[model samples]
Target: MAGRRALKAVLIDLSGTLHIEDTAVPGAQDALNRLRQASVAVKFVTNTTKESKQNLLERLQHLNFNLHEKEIFTSLSAARSLLEQKQLRPLLLVEDSALEDFNGIDTLEPNSVVVGLAPDHFNYQTLNRAFRLILDGAPLIAIHKARYYKQKDGLALGPGPFVTGLEYATDCKATVVGKPEKSFFTQALTDVGCSPSEAVMIGDDARDDVGGAQNAGMLGILVKTGKYREGDENKINPPPHLTCDSFPDAVEHILQNLL
Candidate 1:
Protein backbone atom coordinates (compact mmCIF):
# COMPACT_ATOMS: atom_id res chain seq x y z
CA MET A 1 0.00 0.00 0.00
CA ALA A 2 1.29 3.44 -0.92
CA GLY A 3 0.09 5.40 2.09
CA ARG A 4 0.73 2.82 4.79
CA ARG A 5 0.78 4.34 8.25
CA ALA A 6 1.07 2.89 11.73
CA LEU A 7 -2.16 1.04 12.45
CA LYS A 8 -3.93 2.78 15.28
CA ALA A 9 -7.47 1.51 14.91
CA VAL A 10 -9.36 -1.28 13.21
CA LEU A 11 -12.93 -0.69 12.07
CA ILE A 12 -14.75 -3.99 11.54
CA ASP A 13 -18.04 -4.87 9.94
CA LEU A 14 -20.18 -6.79 12.38
CA SER A 15 -22.78 -8.90 10.58
CA GLY A 16 -20.86 -10.52 7.80
CA THR A 17 -17.26 -10.29 8.85
CA LEU A 18 -17.54 -11.38 12.44
CA HIS A 19 -20.78 -13.32 12.35
CA ILE A 20 -23.78 -14.05 10.24
CA GLU A 21 -26.98 -13.90 12.19
CA ASP A 22 -26.52 -15.83 15.47
CA THR A 23 -23.63 -17.95 14.23
CA ALA A 24 -20.15 -16.62 14.83
CA VAL A 25 -17.57 -16.88 12.08
CA PRO A 26 -15.02 -19.58 12.76
CA GLY A 27 -12.18 -18.35 14.97
CA ALA A 28 -13.54 -14.77 14.85
CA GLN A 29 -13.95 -14.43 18.63
CA ASP A 30 -10.44 -15.67 19.29
CA ALA A 31 -9.09 -13.51 16.48
CA LEU A 32 -10.63 -10.43 18.02
CA ASN A 33 -9.08 -11.39 21.31
CA ARG A 34 -5.73 -11.45 19.59
CA LEU A 35 -6.28 -7.94 18.37
CA ARG A 36 -7.30 -6.93 21.87
CA GLN A 37 -4.10 -8.41 23.29
CA ALA A 38 -2.09 -6.44 20.73
CA SER A 39 -3.50 -3.24 22.19
CA VAL A 40 -5.10 -2.07 18.96
CA ALA A 41 -8.08 0.18 19.17
CA VAL A 42 -10.99 -1.83 17.78
CA LYS A 43 -14.35 -0.44 16.78
CA PHE A 44 -17.35 -2.15 15.25
CA VAL A 45 -18.91 -0.19 12.42
CA THR A 46 -22.09 -1.59 10.97
CA ASN A 47 -24.79 -0.64 8.50
CA THR A 48 -27.20 -2.98 10.27
CA THR A 49 -30.52 -1.22 10.82
CA LYS A 50 -32.53 -4.29 11.74
CA GLU A 51 -32.05 -3.74 15.48
CA SER A 52 -30.97 -1.07 17.91
CA LYS A 53 -27.40 -0.83 19.15
CA GLN A 54 -28.34 -2.25 22.54
CA ASN A 55 -29.94 -5.26 20.91
CA LEU A 56 -26.98 -5.68 18.62
CA LEU A 57 -24.60 -5.69 21.55
CA GLU A 58 -26.69 -8.30 23.28
CA ARG A 59 -26.55 -10.47 20.20
CA LEU A 60 -22.76 -10.11 20.05
CA GLN A 61 -22.44 -11.04 23.70
CA HIS A 62 -24.66 -14.04 23.08
CA LEU A 63 -22.25 -15.03 20.37
CA ASN A 64 -19.36 -14.71 22.87
CA PHE A 65 -17.85 -11.50 21.53
CA ASN A 66 -16.76 -9.09 24.23
CA LEU A 67 -17.18 -5.43 23.34
CA HIS A 68 -18.68 -2.27 24.70
CA GLU A 69 -21.76 -0.57 23.26
CA LYS A 70 -20.01 2.73 22.75
CA GLU A 71 -17.35 0.99 20.68
CA ILE A 72 -20.01 0.22 18.09
CA PHE A 73 -20.80 2.92 15.56
CA THR A 74 -23.75 2.36 13.28
CA SER A 75 -25.37 3.91 10.24
CA LEU A 76 -28.55 4.29 12.26
CA SER A 77 -26.60 6.56 14.58
CA ALA A 78 -25.41 8.53 11.58
CA ALA A 79 -28.92 8.82 10.15
CA ARG A 80 -30.19 10.00 13.52
CA SER A 81 -27.42 12.56 13.75
CA LEU A 82 -28.36 13.84 10.32
CA LEU A 83 -32.00 14.05 11.30
CA GLU A 84 -31.09 16.00 14.41
CA GLN A 85 -28.71 18.27 12.57
CA LYS A 86 -31.40 19.17 10.07
CA GLN A 87 -34.17 19.18 12.71
CA LEU A 88 -36.38 17.26 10.36
CA ARG A 89 -38.96 14.92 11.78
CA PRO A 90 -38.96 11.79 9.66
CA LEU A 91 -41.38 9.07 8.77
CA LEU A 92 -39.12 6.15 9.51
CA LEU A 93 -39.54 3.03 7.36
CA VAL A 94 -37.22 0.89 9.43
CA GLU A 95 -37.68 -2.18 11.57
CA ASP A 96 -39.55 -1.75 14.85
CA SER A 97 -36.52 -3.10 16.68
CA ALA A 98 -34.36 -0.39 15.16
CA LEU A 99 -36.65 2.40 16.29
CA GLU A 100 -35.08 2.56 19.75
CA ASP A 101 -32.14 4.43 18.33
CA PHE A 102 -34.44 7.20 17.15
CA ASN A 103 -36.55 7.26 20.29
CA GLY A 104 -36.09 10.94 21.10
CA ILE A 105 -36.64 12.16 17.55
CA ASP A 106 -39.94 13.75 16.65
CA THR A 107 -41.98 11.62 14.24
CA LEU A 108 -45.15 13.67 14.21
CA GLU A 109 -46.12 15.00 10.80
CA PRO A 110 -42.89 13.78 9.34
CA ASN A 111 -41.24 16.26 7.02
CA SER A 112 -38.83 13.65 5.69
CA VAL A 113 -38.62 9.90 4.99
CA VAL A 114 -35.89 7.70 6.50
CA VAL A 115 -35.66 4.18 5.14
CA GLY A 116 -33.74 1.04 6.06
CA LEU A 117 -34.34 -2.70 5.76
CA ALA A 118 -37.90 -3.13 7.00
CA PRO A 119 -39.62 -6.07 5.31
CA ASP A 120 -42.82 -5.46 7.25
CA HIS A 121 -42.83 -1.77 6.35
CA PHE A 122 -42.03 -2.30 2.69
CA ASN A 123 -45.58 -3.20 1.82
CA TYR A 124 -47.66 -1.27 -0.71
CA GLN A 125 -49.63 0.94 1.68
CA THR A 126 -46.61 1.99 3.70
CA LEU A 127 -44.44 2.51 0.64
CA ASN A 128 -47.19 4.55 -0.98
CA ARG A 129 -47.37 6.70 2.12
CA ALA A 130 -43.66 7.37 1.88
CA PHE A 131 -44.08 7.91 -1.87
CA ARG A 132 -46.70 10.57 -1.35
CA LEU A 133 -44.60 12.21 1.34
CA ILE A 134 -41.55 12.36 -0.91
CA LEU A 135 -43.67 13.58 -3.82
CA ASP A 136 -44.82 16.40 -1.53
CA GLY A 137 -41.27 17.62 -1.00
CA ALA A 138 -40.15 15.45 1.90
CA PRO A 139 -36.52 14.46 1.60
CA LEU A 140 -35.66 10.77 1.45
CA ILE A 141 -32.81 9.50 3.60
CA ALA A 142 -31.45 5.99 3.10
CA ILE A 143 -29.40 4.53 5.94
CA HIS A 144 -27.65 2.32 3.43
CA LYS A 145 -28.40 1.05 -0.06
CA ALA A 146 -26.86 -2.37 0.19
CA ARG A 147 -28.28 -4.59 -2.54
CA TYR A 148 -28.42 -7.61 -0.27
CA TYR A 149 -27.03 -8.97 2.96
CA LYS A 150 -26.12 -12.37 4.33
CA GLN A 151 -28.60 -14.33 6.40
CA LYS A 152 -28.29 -17.79 7.94
CA ASP A 153 -30.28 -19.02 4.94
CA GLY A 154 -28.44 -17.65 1.96
CA LEU A 155 -28.81 -13.95 0.97
CA ALA A 156 -31.77 -11.65 1.32
CA LEU A 157 -32.76 -8.39 -0.31
CA GLY A 158 -31.65 -5.19 1.34
CA PRO A 159 -33.25 -1.74 1.17
CA GLY A 160 -31.38 -0.63 -1.92
CA PRO A 161 -34.10 -1.60 -4.34
CA PHE A 162 -36.74 0.07 -2.23
CA VAL A 163 -34.63 3.20 -1.96
CA THR A 164 -34.12 3.16 -5.71
CA GLY A 165 -37.82 2.70 -6.34
CA LEU A 166 -38.58 5.76 -4.23
CA GLU A 167 -35.90 7.69 -6.01
CA TYR A 168 -37.33 6.75 -9.35
CA ALA A 169 -40.87 7.58 -8.32
CA THR A 170 -40.09 10.94 -6.78
CA ASP A 171 -37.18 11.76 -9.09
CA CYS A 172 -35.27 12.89 -6.03
CA LYS A 173 -31.97 11.41 -4.99
CA ALA A 174 -31.97 10.09 -1.45
CA THR A 175 -29.22 11.16 0.92
CA VAL A 176 -27.31 8.00 1.92
CA VAL A 177 -25.67 7.90 5.34
CA GLY A 178 -24.12 4.44 5.51
CA LYS A 179 -21.22 2.41 4.20
CA PRO A 180 -19.48 3.48 0.99
CA GLU A 181 -20.37 6.98 2.05
CA LYS A 182 -17.33 9.03 2.96
CA SER A 183 -19.15 10.89 5.71
CA PHE A 184 -19.95 7.64 7.54
CA PHE A 185 -16.30 6.58 7.45
CA THR A 186 -15.22 10.03 8.58
CA GLN A 187 -17.58 9.91 11.53
CA ALA A 188 -16.47 6.41 12.54
CA LEU A 189 -12.79 7.35 12.31
CA THR A 190 -13.35 10.49 14.35
CA ASP A 191 -14.70 8.45 17.27
CA VAL A 192 -11.46 6.45 17.47
CA GLY A 193 -9.24 9.53 17.06
CA CYS A 194 -7.59 7.90 14.07
CA SER A 195 -6.92 9.35 10.66
CA PRO A 196 -8.05 7.36 7.65
CA SER A 197 -4.48 6.37 6.86
CA GLU A 198 -4.03 4.91 10.32
CA ALA A 199 -7.10 2.69 10.17
CA VAL A 200 -8.07 -0.50 8.38
CA MET A 201 -11.61 -1.60 7.52
CA ILE A 202 -12.46 -5.30 7.35
CA GLY A 203 -15.73 -6.55 5.97
CA ASP A 204 -17.34 -9.06 3.59
CA ASP A 205 -19.05 -6.74 1.18
CA ALA A 206 -16.49 -5.70 -1.37
CA ARG A 207 -18.41 -2.70 -2.64
CA ASP A 208 -19.67 -1.12 0.54
CA ASP A 209 -17.19 -2.27 3.19
CA VAL A 210 -14.01 -2.63 1.16
CA GLY A 211 -14.49 -0.14 -1.64
CA GLY A 212 -16.07 2.47 0.56
CA ALA A 213 -13.30 2.35 3.13
CA GLN A 214 -10.66 2.51 0.43
CA ASN A 215 -12.33 5.54 -1.07
CA ALA A 216 -12.27 7.15 2.36
CA GLY A 217 -8.46 6.64 2.57
CA MET A 218 -8.35 3.57 4.81
CA LEU A 219 -6.89 0.23 3.94
CA GLY A 220 -9.76 -2.05 3.03
CA ILE A 221 -9.61 -5.81 3.60
CA LEU A 222 -12.32 -7.91 2.01
CA VAL A 223 -13.06 -11.16 3.81
CA LYS A 224 -14.31 -14.16 1.90
CA THR A 225 -17.28 -14.69 4.11
CA GLY A 226 -20.80 -13.32 4.63
CA LYS A 227 -22.34 -12.06 1.39
CA TYR A 228 -19.07 -12.44 -0.41
CA ARG A 229 -19.05 -14.18 -3.79
CA GLU A 230 -16.10 -15.20 -5.87
CA GLY A 231 -14.63 -12.39 -8.01
CA ASP A 232 -16.25 -9.72 -5.86
CA GLU A 233 -12.94 -7.99 -5.34
CA ASN A 234 -12.64 -7.37 -9.07
CA LYS A 235 -15.99 -5.57 -9.04
CA ILE A 236 -14.39 -2.60 -7.31
CA ASN A 237 -11.86 -0.34 -8.90
CA PRO A 238 -8.61 -0.40 -6.93
CA PRO A 239 -9.34 -3.70 -5.19
CA PRO A 240 -9.04 -4.19 -1.45
CA HIS A 241 -5.60 -3.96 0.18
CA LEU A 242 -6.00 -7.58 1.21
CA THR A 243 -8.65 -10.21 0.56
CA CYS A 244 -8.49 -12.86 3.25
CA ASP A 245 -10.43 -16.07 3.83
CA SER A 246 -12.21 -14.84 6.93
CA PHE A 247 -12.12 -12.47 9.89
CA PRO A 248 -9.42 -14.46 11.68
CA ASP A 249 -7.23 -14.48 8.58
CA ALA A 250 -7.57 -10.72 8.28
CA VAL A 251 -6.50 -10.35 11.91
CA GLU A 252 -3.46 -12.55 11.38
CA HIS A 253 -2.41 -10.27 8.51
CA ILE A 254 -2.77 -7.20 10.70
CA LEU A 255 -0.72 -8.72 13.47
CA GLN A 256 1.96 -10.05 11.18
CA ASN A 257 2.39 -7.23 8.68
CA LEU A 258 0.44 -4.08 9.48
CA LEU A 259 1.56 -3.84 13.08
Candidate 2:
Protein backbone atom coordinates (compact mmCIF):
# COMPACT_ATOMS: atom_id res chain seq x y z
CA MET A 1 0.00 0.00 0.00
CA ALA A 2 2.85 2.40 0.83
CA GLY A 3 4.70 1.67 -2.40
CA ARG A 4 1.97 1.54 -5.00
CA ARG A 5 2.57 3.61 -8.09
CA ALA A 6 0.06 6.25 -9.12
CA LEU A 7 -2.28 4.67 -11.64
CA LYS A 8 -2.24 6.49 -14.96
CA ALA A 9 -5.03 4.83 -16.96
CA VAL A 10 -7.86 2.32 -16.79
CA LEU A 11 -9.23 -0.33 -19.09
CA ILE A 12 -12.91 -0.88 -18.44
CA ASP A 13 -14.91 -3.92 -19.47
CA LEU A 14 -18.27 -3.38 -21.12
CA SER A 15 -21.09 -5.96 -20.90
CA GLY A 16 -20.60 -6.94 -17.29
CA THR A 17 -18.88 -3.94 -15.81
CA LEU A 18 -20.94 -1.03 -17.08
CA HIS A 19 -24.17 -2.71 -18.16
CA ILE A 20 -26.06 -5.92 -18.20
CA GLU A 21 -27.72 -6.61 -21.53
CA ASP A 22 -29.48 -3.46 -22.73
CA THR A 23 -29.60 -1.74 -19.35
CA ALA A 24 -26.90 0.33 -17.70
CA VAL A 25 -25.84 -0.57 -14.21
CA PRO A 26 -27.26 1.77 -11.62
CA GLY A 27 -24.95 4.80 -11.21
CA ALA A 28 -22.44 3.52 -13.73
CA GLN A 29 -22.80 6.69 -15.78
CA ASP A 30 -21.91 8.79 -12.78
CA ALA A 31 -18.96 6.57 -11.96
CA LEU A 32 -17.54 7.09 -15.44
CA ASN A 33 -18.17 10.80 -15.11
CA ARG A 34 -16.13 10.79 -11.93
CA LEU A 35 -13.34 8.88 -13.62
CA ARG A 36 -13.22 11.43 -16.40
CA GLN A 37 -13.19 14.28 -13.91
CA ALA A 38 -10.17 12.66 -12.32
CA SER A 39 -8.44 12.90 -15.69
CA VAL A 40 -7.59 9.21 -15.88
CA ALA A 41 -7.33 7.87 -19.39
CA VAL A 42 -10.06 5.31 -19.95
CA LYS A 43 -10.69 2.85 -22.77
CA PHE A 44 -13.77 0.64 -22.94
CA VAL A 45 -12.78 -2.88 -23.88
CA THR A 46 -15.19 -5.77 -24.47
CA ASN A 47 -15.29 -9.32 -25.77
CA THR A 48 -18.83 -9.14 -27.12
CA THR A 49 -19.29 -10.13 -30.72
CA LYS A 50 -23.04 -9.84 -30.89
CA GLU A 51 -22.82 -6.44 -32.58
CA SER A 52 -20.58 -4.33 -34.74
CA LYS A 53 -18.46 -1.51 -33.32
CA GLN A 54 -21.04 1.06 -34.41
CA ASN A 55 -23.79 -0.93 -32.81
CA LEU A 56 -21.79 -1.29 -29.59
CA LEU A 57 -21.07 2.44 -29.47
CA GLU A 58 -24.72 3.21 -30.12
CA ARG A 59 -25.80 0.85 -27.40
CA LEU A 60 -23.43 2.39 -24.88
CA GLN A 61 -24.67 5.85 -25.78
CA HIS A 62 -28.26 4.68 -25.39
CA LEU A 63 -27.37 3.56 -21.88
CA ASN A 64 -25.97 7.01 -21.09
CA PHE A 65 -22.31 6.05 -20.98
CA ASN A 66 -19.70 8.76 -21.61
CA LEU A 67 -17.68 7.20 -24.37
CA HIS A 68 -16.51 7.76 -27.90
CA GLU A 69 -16.00 5.36 -30.80
CA LYS A 70 -12.24 5.57 -30.45
CA GLU A 71 -12.42 4.53 -26.81
CA ILE A 72 -14.36 1.35 -27.53
CA PHE A 73 -12.33 -1.73 -28.38
CA THR A 74 -14.00 -5.06 -29.06
CA SER A 75 -12.92 -8.57 -29.93
CA LEU A 76 -14.53 -8.15 -33.31
CA SER A 77 -12.28 -5.17 -33.92
CA ALA A 78 -9.21 -7.22 -32.99
CA ALA A 79 -10.31 -10.05 -35.26
CA ARG A 80 -10.74 -7.70 -38.19
CA SER A 81 -7.34 -6.19 -37.60
CA LEU A 82 -5.72 -9.61 -37.49
CA LEU A 83 -7.45 -10.66 -40.68
CA GLU A 84 -6.36 -7.57 -42.55
CA GLN A 85 -2.80 -7.79 -41.28
CA LYS A 86 -2.43 -11.38 -42.44
CA GLN A 87 -4.43 -10.78 -45.63
CA LEU A 88 -6.44 -13.93 -44.94
CA ARG A 89 -9.92 -14.47 -46.29
CA PRO A 90 -12.16 -15.25 -43.31
CA LEU A 91 -15.14 -17.56 -43.20
CA LEU A 92 -16.66 -15.48 -40.45
CA LEU A 93 -18.80 -17.48 -38.01
CA VAL A 94 -20.11 -14.47 -36.18
CA GLU A 95 -23.55 -13.03 -35.47
CA ASP A 96 -25.34 -11.25 -38.30
CA SER A 97 -25.08 -8.00 -36.39
CA ALA A 98 -21.29 -8.26 -36.36
CA LEU A 99 -20.80 -9.03 -40.03
CA GLU A 100 -20.79 -5.34 -40.91
CA ASP A 101 -17.41 -4.99 -39.21
CA PHE A 102 -15.96 -7.15 -41.94
CA ASN A 103 -17.98 -5.77 -44.79
CA GLY A 104 -16.26 -5.25 -48.17
CA ILE A 105 -13.36 -7.44 -47.05
CA ASP A 106 -12.51 -10.23 -49.46
CA THR A 107 -13.92 -13.47 -47.97
CA LEU A 108 -13.82 -15.56 -51.10
CA GLU A 109 -12.66 -19.17 -50.68
CA PRO A 110 -12.29 -18.58 -46.98
CA ASN A 111 -9.24 -20.18 -45.40
CA SER A 112 -9.72 -18.94 -41.84
CA VAL A 113 -12.61 -19.69 -39.50
CA VAL A 114 -13.33 -16.77 -37.21
CA VAL A 115 -15.71 -17.69 -34.39
CA GLY A 116 -17.63 -15.32 -32.18
CA LEU A 117 -20.64 -15.67 -29.87
CA ALA A 118 -23.47 -16.03 -32.37
CA PRO A 119 -26.14 -18.47 -31.18
CA ASP A 120 -28.11 -18.01 -34.35
CA HIS A 121 -25.13 -18.95 -36.45
CA PHE A 122 -24.43 -22.31 -34.74
CA ASN A 123 -26.81 -24.58 -36.52
CA TYR A 124 -25.60 -27.96 -37.75
CA GLN A 125 -25.32 -26.87 -41.33
CA THR A 126 -23.45 -23.70 -40.52
CA LEU A 127 -21.18 -25.37 -37.99
CA ASN A 128 -20.59 -28.24 -40.38
CA ARG A 129 -19.44 -25.81 -43.02
CA ALA A 130 -17.02 -24.25 -40.58
CA PHE A 131 -15.93 -27.66 -39.38
CA ARG A 132 -15.24 -28.83 -42.90
CA LEU A 133 -13.18 -25.79 -43.58
CA ILE A 134 -11.16 -26.24 -40.42
CA LEU A 135 -10.67 -29.88 -41.24
CA ASP A 136 -9.31 -28.80 -44.55
CA GLY A 137 -6.52 -26.91 -42.73
CA ALA A 138 -8.11 -23.53 -42.15
CA PRO A 139 -6.92 -21.82 -39.01
CA LEU A 140 -9.48 -21.28 -36.27
CA ILE A 141 -9.54 -17.77 -34.95
CA ALA A 142 -11.62 -17.27 -31.83
CA ILE A 143 -12.61 -13.68 -31.25
CA HIS A 144 -13.41 -14.64 -27.68
CA LYS A 145 -13.77 -17.70 -25.53
CA ALA A 146 -15.89 -16.43 -22.68
CA ARG A 147 -17.58 -19.37 -20.95
CA TYR A 148 -20.77 -17.58 -19.85
CA TYR A 149 -22.20 -14.15 -19.34
CA LYS A 150 -25.01 -12.71 -17.28
CA GLN A 151 -28.14 -11.81 -19.22
CA LYS A 152 -31.37 -10.04 -18.30
CA ASP A 153 -33.05 -13.31 -17.47
CA GLY A 154 -30.09 -15.29 -16.20
CA LEU A 155 -26.64 -16.55 -17.12
CA ALA A 156 -26.22 -17.82 -20.65
CA LEU A 157 -23.59 -19.73 -22.59
CA GLY A 158 -20.77 -17.82 -24.26
CA PRO A 159 -18.63 -18.88 -27.20
CA GLY A 160 -15.89 -20.61 -25.22
CA PRO A 161 -17.58 -23.98 -25.26
CA PHE A 162 -18.05 -23.83 -28.98
CA VAL A 163 -14.48 -22.76 -29.51
CA THR A 164 -13.30 -25.66 -27.37
CA GLY A 165 -15.46 -28.07 -29.30
CA LEU A 166 -13.95 -26.98 -32.56
CA GLU A 167 -10.50 -27.19 -31.09
CA TYR A 168 -11.12 -30.74 -29.88
CA ALA A 169 -12.48 -31.91 -33.21
CA THR A 170 -9.92 -30.20 -35.38
CA ASP A 171 -6.88 -30.82 -33.20
CA CYS A 172 -5.72 -27.33 -34.07
CA LYS A 173 -5.01 -24.61 -31.55
CA ALA A 174 -7.05 -21.49 -31.93
CA THR A 175 -5.70 -18.00 -32.28
CA VAL A 176 -7.48 -16.18 -29.46
CA VAL A 177 -7.82 -12.45 -30.02
CA GLY A 178 -9.83 -11.35 -27.00
CA LYS A 179 -9.66 -11.11 -23.23
CA PRO A 180 -7.67 -13.67 -21.20
CA GLU A 181 -5.06 -13.18 -23.87
CA LYS A 182 -2.20 -10.87 -22.85
CA SER A 183 -1.90 -9.39 -26.30
CA PHE A 184 -5.38 -7.84 -26.16
CA PHE A 185 -4.69 -5.96 -22.93
CA THR A 186 -1.19 -4.97 -24.00
CA GLN A 187 -2.52 -3.66 -27.28
CA ALA A 188 -5.10 -1.52 -25.49
CA LEU A 189 -2.50 -0.17 -23.09
CA THR A 190 -0.24 0.66 -26.03
CA ASP A 191 -3.05 2.44 -27.83
CA VAL A 192 -3.68 4.67 -24.83
CA GLY A 193 0.04 5.47 -24.39
CA CYS A 194 0.27 3.82 -20.99
CA SER A 195 2.61 1.18 -19.70
CA PRO A 196 0.96 -1.98 -18.40
CA SER A 197 2.21 -1.29 -14.86
CA GLU A 198 0.75 2.20 -14.92
CA ALA A 199 -2.84 1.07 -15.50
CA VAL A 200 -5.61 -1.07 -14.04
CA MET A 201 -8.35 -3.21 -15.61
CA ILE A 202 -11.86 -3.41 -14.19
CA GLY A 203 -14.38 -6.02 -15.14
CA ASP A 204 -16.60 -8.89 -13.91
CA ASP A 205 -15.22 -11.97 -15.53
CA ALA A 206 -12.61 -13.49 -13.20
CA ARG A 207 -10.88 -15.55 -15.84
CA ASP A 208 -10.89 -13.16 -18.75
CA ASP A 209 -11.02 -9.62 -17.43
CA VAL A 210 -9.30 -9.96 -14.08
CA GLY A 211 -6.94 -12.82 -14.74
CA GLY A 212 -6.16 -11.56 -18.21
CA ALA A 213 -5.20 -8.07 -17.08
CA GLN A 214 -3.09 -9.36 -14.23
CA ASN A 215 -1.33 -11.71 -16.59
CA ALA A 216 -0.68 -8.79 -18.91
CA GLY A 217 1.22 -6.99 -16.06
CA MET A 218 -1.56 -4.65 -14.98
CA LEU A 219 -3.51 -4.49 -11.76
CA GLY A 220 -7.01 -5.99 -12.00
CA ILE A 221 -10.10 -5.01 -10.05
CA LEU A 222 -12.96 -7.49 -10.13
CA VAL A 223 -16.47 -6.06 -9.96
CA LYS A 224 -19.34 -8.17 -8.72
CA THR A 225 -21.85 -7.27 -11.37
CA GLY A 226 -22.93 -9.16 -14.46
CA LYS A 227 -21.51 -12.68 -14.94
CA TYR A 228 -19.76 -12.58 -11.60
CA ARG A 229 -20.40 -15.53 -9.34
CA GLU A 230 -19.99 -15.48 -5.58
CA GLY A 231 -16.55 -17.15 -5.60
CA ASP A 232 -15.48 -16.24 -9.09
CA GLU A 233 -12.68 -14.00 -7.93
CA ASN A 234 -11.29 -16.69 -5.66
CA LYS A 235 -11.09 -19.13 -8.56
CA ILE A 236 -8.32 -17.28 -10.25
CA ASN A 237 -4.73 -18.08 -9.23
CA PRO A 238 -3.33 -14.57 -8.94
CA PRO A 239 -6.29 -12.74 -7.43
CA PRO A 240 -7.42 -9.26 -8.38
CA HIS A 241 -5.81 -6.42 -6.49
CA LEU A 242 -9.26 -5.33 -5.40
CA THR A 243 -12.89 -6.44 -5.64
CA CYS A 244 -15.96 -4.26 -5.63
CA ASP A 245 -19.65 -4.74 -6.17
CA SER A 246 -19.96 -2.31 -9.07
CA PHE A 247 -18.09 0.09 -11.29
CA PRO A 248 -18.82 2.95 -8.94
CA ASP A 249 -17.25 1.05 -6.09
CA ALA A 250 -14.26 0.13 -8.20
CA VAL A 251 -13.87 3.75 -9.19
CA GLU A 252 -13.83 4.73 -5.54
CA HIS A 253 -10.94 2.34 -4.93
CA ILE A 254 -9.04 3.78 -7.86
CA LEU A 255 -9.56 7.34 -6.70
CA GLN A 256 -8.33 6.57 -3.22
CA ASN A 257 -5.41 4.25 -3.93
CA LEU A 258 -4.10 5.43 -7.27
CA LEU A 259 -4.95 9.12 -7.61
Q: What's the TM for model 1? A: 0.98
**Relative to the true structure, how large is the alpha-carbon lDDT of every model?**
0.95, 0.90
For model 2, the run of ten residues with the poorest summed lDDT: 1-10
The digit string of per-residue lDDT tens for model 2 on 228-259 reads: 98999899988889988999999998988788
lDDT of 1 at 15: 93
Model 2 per-residue lDDT at 40: 80
How accurate locally is residue 184 in candidate 2, as Cα lDDT from 0 to 100? 93
Candidate 1 lDDT for residue 40? 74
- Native-referenced Cα lDDT, model 1: 0.95
In the range 1-259, model 1's lDDT, one tens digit per residue, is 4557789999999998999888999999999999999867999999999999999999999999989999999999999999999999999999999999999999999999999999999999999999999999999999999999977778889999999999999999999999989999989988678889999999999999999999999999999999999999999999899998999999999999998
User: Going through the candidates in order, what is the number of backbone clashes in each?
Assistant: 0, 0
User: After TM-score superposition, what is the CA distance of residue 73 in candidate 1 from its true location, in Å?
Assistant: 0.4
Off by over 4 Å in 1: 1-3
